[model samples]
Target: MSRIGKKPVELPSGVEATVSGQTIEVKGPKGTRSFKATDDVTFSVENNAITVTPRGKSKRARQQWGMSRSMVENLVTGVTTGFKKELEINGVGYRATMQGDKVLKLALGYSHDVNFEVPEGVTVTAPKQTEIIVEGIDQQLVGQVAANIREWRAPEPYKGKGIKYKGEYIFRKEGKKK
Candidate 1:
């Protein structure tokens, strides 16, 4: 028995979960999310809780069982409480701002400014000139957007001039002496 798979997901208030065939849909005040289970994975909701079970003993089946369960649980939680990712800009003259219509324009000490268009269902906010916050109900989409933004200018090991997670740690490397 899988420890994580055995644990039941508790349904929060104002959240409704439904299971149909291999698909599970969760609706909440924030939004609605759905996940499709694999062939060997099954899920059911009982007493405001959700459970996952595997249909076969194969390795793939076991893997899918756990993955599907976790995905469904994340979907439920995301819709209820949502998810957030924070990014910070480093280096002199490096900053970020939200442009019109889900577009984020960034200045990372480059020759030209970079423009990143945010995906639907994801909200991007800039509290300060260098701090960025991304929120959404979909975990996958949230993460992908964060990654894409981070990719614009990953922190360098020498000066660390770029974009990075708010609290992420980056090991500094020694610069070569001229």
Candidate 2:
């Protein structure tokens, strides 16, 4: 009954997948990733395509059907094309720079600079003072790192000054009447 679950995930050339028990592992040019699904769903790989099927008609089974399918797709995509998150810095003094190979130095109007450590398995780069690029084979990790950076100085409404995701819109508000 799940539309998304019904569609099989097609594996691109040079990408491989293996389903064992409740765990599915996908390997590709970029890297390898694995996901373990609940017992409510089953995974099957055939003809370079992965299909997820619910074991019963229960609500939990149906829910796992779509969730498992999407997880498999993400693993495949993560290993192949990887993932990227872009962040933009606002405000006059707000900017970011790579301190060295593993640290990011951010100036966001704080009395002192904010030092953000880059975690393993992900790459953080600052192409420009106003731009930050987060890239990795794991989609979730890439997004989490970007979010952590944005948390330092979330965009405000008045001047829209702060760190924000690229293309994000800030709803502005007028100042209080005198």
Q: List runs of model 1 lying over 4 Å from the truth.
A: none
Alpha-carbon deviation at 34 in model 1, angstroms: 0.2
lDDT of 2 by residue, 67-113 (tens): 98998999988998999999999999789999887999999999999
Give stretches of model 2 more than 4 Å off.
Answer: none
TM-score of each: 0.96, 0.98
Q: Would you give me the overall lDDT of model 2? A: 0.95
- Cα lDDT of candidate 1 equals 0.89
The candidate maximizing TM-score is 2
TM-score between model 2 and native: 0.98
> In candidate 1, residue 82 scores what lDDT?
96
